[model samples]
Target: MSLLSGLPLQFSIDVSSLLNVVWLGSIFVFFIYGQRLQMYLIANDISRALNRLKIMRDKSRKEAIDYFTSSGKVTGDPTQRIDEFLDYVTIMPVDMDPRGVVEKVQHITNTRDERVRAEVSQIIPNLDPTKVSVAENILEIATSLNQIHKIVRHYYLLGKKTNSYMLLFQLQMIMPMVLQEADALVNAVDTFKLGQPVGDGIGPVIASRYMQNLPKQVVGKDTVMTVGEYKGRTLYVLKAEGPMGYVGEPGVAIQKLIEEMKVPLNAIIMVDAALKLEGEKTGEIAEGVGAAIGGIGVDKFKIEEVSSTHKIPVYAILVKQSILEAITVMRKEIAEASDKVQVLINRVIEEKTKEGDKVLLAGIGNTLGVGQ
Candidate 1:
């Protein structure tokens, strides 16, 4: 303060200017600090969301194991603890491709299914295959719901905290689809757990119920293709061999009947449930062209390929319902549609082809809680 202050002839300082500068510098630092604080908050929220996701995944995994524990007949012993194995299990995305995708998607689903069945077999040797399938479907849906909820919630919270209008806008835009899928997953799990017939299984039930009463023989892929005399045509009815829950590789079954059985199929008719748009009445019947199968398009691909190659005209008879109804408990309207569809099938067969001509009828859908 003595020597240095005196020597400051080279530099000059204004006290009032210095004070103002210090104030401005402080303000600048605080502005930067505030910006960093905002960034930290956004990042922390996202991190917390991801951590929540992990917790949900682990929780669902535990729940699945607990479900197996409660089913003594399935798990061999209900009291015994089983190690949780499905944590972070990878499920493949559905293939939306029109061609050359079934093998890839099927490999993933088939491998997982085999692994699940094997695990069940290992844990409770000689366990019923049907129970294992049910557990697998339920576990899959539970996992899906957990994933959807956590992801959508993460974005939702992030948008809210940051007040980012665009981010929130986009999230709002897509949340309906996310919610729809979650609802369907929840419905499917409930339907399976309740042992109730789902809307998707109605068409398959009719085909299965009718086929069971007829004198039938195995054609291909364990699909029972029966020849029945309808009007003048020898109607060949095909459905995935069931008493178990399966959508029965209808694509391959049709391929076998067409490419292998090589029966002179004059017309091809398929039946299944279809998703109706909002405002459309449930259980409404719609008849059109093409295979009425809902999946990753592998089965649809096979049907289209074979039908096109064989020059067989394809006719579709569909029962319309909401996505929830398709997976949830079958509604009374849908249950009644079974009889209506049966009559429609008979009329389609009678009108579509000539007498003495051979026709192929494939019932396509998950045959859960359905007989024959």
Candidate 2:
């Protein structure tokens, strides 16, 4: 045995060593305790935000039911409520107040933390200006900033306890989806260009203008038809007014147009608005090549069978809008679909409007409870 190993006659620790151990242990305890507290706080904030969102959604649903039963026309107020609910769902954070999160992030950025600041900044650019009310924007921005700050702070703490490389890899994988959604929201606001036409009795004006210049190749006067070519592809357009709850005629019109055009059925694309979850925004767009004819049983069955038989890529571009606001909202989806399919959503009254500049808009849905 060494001499030092046998030198325990003092039976006491050195004061300096005792102080050092106490200091280090205190720090470790504080760090662990602090992290737990922060996590709890974040969880509480998320719960509160979710509760608020649920309340808003419930209120919106009740309002929609009331309006539908009483007014007989789907009004803008109820639709706006739905839009608000969608916005809330899309933007809410998983663990914190988005505004507070963002503010905290901004602080870290100002303090010269480039790595974390970059991540926060990416989400910042994608926020939709139209979604939030002016007052709400102020509060939300602050909340998001703070939440982001907490995220970064938590991440820093985690790095001290574990390897940051794994955390960074996880973030890299998940951030893209979040960024894509944000981009979609921003693009929806920036490039959305429907509902711009204004005039008293504009619908009739549009209908009459279209009727006078109906294309010869298109069959039937009661059924107005327009033709256009987009991206070196030919397109046939048809529009008609039928009785309420009439979704059959549009399918018939499509068959007639297909026969007249002599184009292969497999190449055709169909676009229309669909009733979606209240969490989906009114003008949100989804693309899939399938028959868009709406209604239960026979009507939908026939259209689906026809498309399936022909091997046609029938694409449906559905706008997530209320069924009661079908006419206006469905029109918007048709226009968006046309744009997406690289076809024009406009009508040509004269041949002066190039074929590439026009697109076919089919207003398809149960016309039940529709019209002025």
Candidate 3:
């Protein structure tokens, strides 16, 4: 105290004692309320994220409603009906027995698709098939956003009611990823509304270009095929009948080509967009062995089944991108990678099969705004 007194007037009164008291006070306060403080901070973060998600969901829903009313013939306000439609749910087929579950799932999926299409058509009776497809996609994006917001809000309220810091913390951790997907879907709504090509369309883009000037015909439900020759190998190029927002049924098409049509194939070469890891670069290409399709496990299961049964080796060329990139507008890097994919496909065929062999070249992904 004497030394402090010599230093300055403000430091003259019991400096050491004051320091000890302040340290003890802070420790005592934190010891009693540290957990509460942490919970409060985490809850604040979750609340902010929850608000953002709500805004996105609401905005998407409004956009969908407006699109339906303006573009389609509607009597009175369609808001109520659209809201009801947004709540549509799909009940998955039970997989306990694990036999014929795939067919059941496919049936349910087909029925759901038909229902959605019919509803959209009813809402906008004036829209052509292409516009109807676009409208269906818009409604789907809104529904997805709506579901995501509800799920997050449920968890947040439940955690708050229970005063469970662990539960809140878990929600906080996943919020960023959840937001990322939500944001991507929001962008997709606009892209789809305008009928623009998406990153998911890269596969079809590659196929279309490779099969340029060749005559194409319907090979499967909403799927198409063309015959071409690549380096003395007979190429059976298959893709979704495009210039529409359709993924078509690549698995069914592949099976039909090999099984139904009895196109003797040496190997199957698939090209599709793949989701990239956090540290990975977008538009990077990788070659692998398998069906490179993404969707409900139905399509993937069918492809694997047919390929295995017929003993046809399947090769995949993947163009890696983020989930955001895959749904939103196609990036320049991804668009440029299509050229590289073609070259890789040629190499796979040359190395995997003989000169006179038939190879099924399948480009698997959505064909939105991509011409056949």
In TM-score terms, which candidate is top? 3
Q: Can you write out model 3's per-residue Cα lDDT over 227-315, one digit (the tens) per residue?
A: 99988989999888878888888888888888888988889989999999889999999999998988998889999999999999999
The residue ranges of model 2 lying beyond 4 angstroms of the native Cα positions read 1-222, 242-248, 259-262, 327-363, 366-372
- TM-score of model 1 relative to the true fold? 0.75
Ten contiguous residues minimizing lDDT sum, candidate 3:
4-13
| lDDT of all predictions | 0.72, 0.39, 0.89
What's the lDDT for residue 320 in model 3?
95
Provide the TM-score for each candidate, comma-separated: 0.75, 0.33, 0.93
How far residue 235's Cα lies from its native spot in candidate 2, in Å, is 1.2
Q: Order the numbered candidates by TM-score, best leading.
A: 3, 1, 2
lDDT of 2: 0.39
Q: Rank the candidates by lDDT, best first.
A: 3, 1, 2
Which one wins by lDDT: 1 or 2?
1
Instruction: Name model 3 segments beyond 4 Å from true.
Output: 1-19
Residue 227, model 2: lDDT of 60
Measured by lDDT, the strongest candidate is 3
Tell me the tens digit of each residue's lDDT in model 1 across 1-372.
Answer: 787867665345566678889999989988868656665565555455445555555555555666676666554553232334433365665557635466777778667767766666666555565666666666676557666766777776777687675675566566556556655665566577656678888777778755766777776543666777778788778776665566667788788877786776789888999999889999999999988888877789888988899899999999999888988888999989888899998898888888789888888877777756
Residue 54, model 1, lDDT: 54
